[model samples]
Target: MNKPANHDERMAKMTFGSVYPHYVIKVEKKGRSKAELHEVITWLTGFDDEKIESLINDKVTFEQFFEQANLHPNAPSIKGMICGYRIEEIDNPLTQKVRYLDKLVDELAKGRKMEKILRTE
Candidate 1:
């Protein structure tokens, strides 16, 4: 899965803040609450509401966001297709993490139970 030469750089430069609203809208349109979205994010990144707000306010890049994240150990369990790529097959670690978030948000929008979305047995 060789990405374009500039893809990684572009993704690195894209601010998490820029994409936050889209995630919010995606879930909200499906009758999901913002709290649920935050919970999913916290489960993956270990960032609480305050830190997430700060990151959004500061316009942190995905690179910086993931760099500061204490990524959940269960993150590897997240699998499926997102944005035309398979999560487990993504060659780029950063891209994979980004897609993992996308996949979780997609699940939430699809009304998957929180327990399953969190991958808790």
Candidate 2:
């Protein structure tokens, strides 16, 4: 049986696997934490959730998972060894996460305030 188009769309909509293919991520040039860097970068890649699940389930290799992903792109401000995404333009996952967290927190605060009012009434 063939999966529905929705399956692909669902996958496309997923954030864990959705990588910002065109962002520039630069870690400290002198950082020697390859393992840490790899771990951090993996989550930001598209299909991150799927890839992470596969890693846990033993379905794919790390290289294959992030095959299209890139390291931090070069930054013009500083002059030193640098690495980041190599795409023309991409959104940064960190920024997205921050925005999401902020929104979530605001929602929770509103909920809490509502709860307090309800409790008093």
Best by lDDT: 1
Candidate 2 residue-wise lDDT, 1-121, digit = tens = 2335454334334353233221112222333233333333442343354445554355433334334444223211112111232222224433333233223223233333423212222
Assess each prediction's global lDDT (C-alpha) against the native. 0.95, 0.32
C-alpha TM-scores of all predictions: 0.96, 0.20
**Global Cα lDDT for candidate 1:** 0.95
Give the clash count for each candidate: 0, 19
Estimate, for each residue in 3-62, the C-alpha lDDT of model 1 and write its tens digit: 688987888889999999999999999999999999999999999999999999999999
RMSD of each: 1.1, 17.4
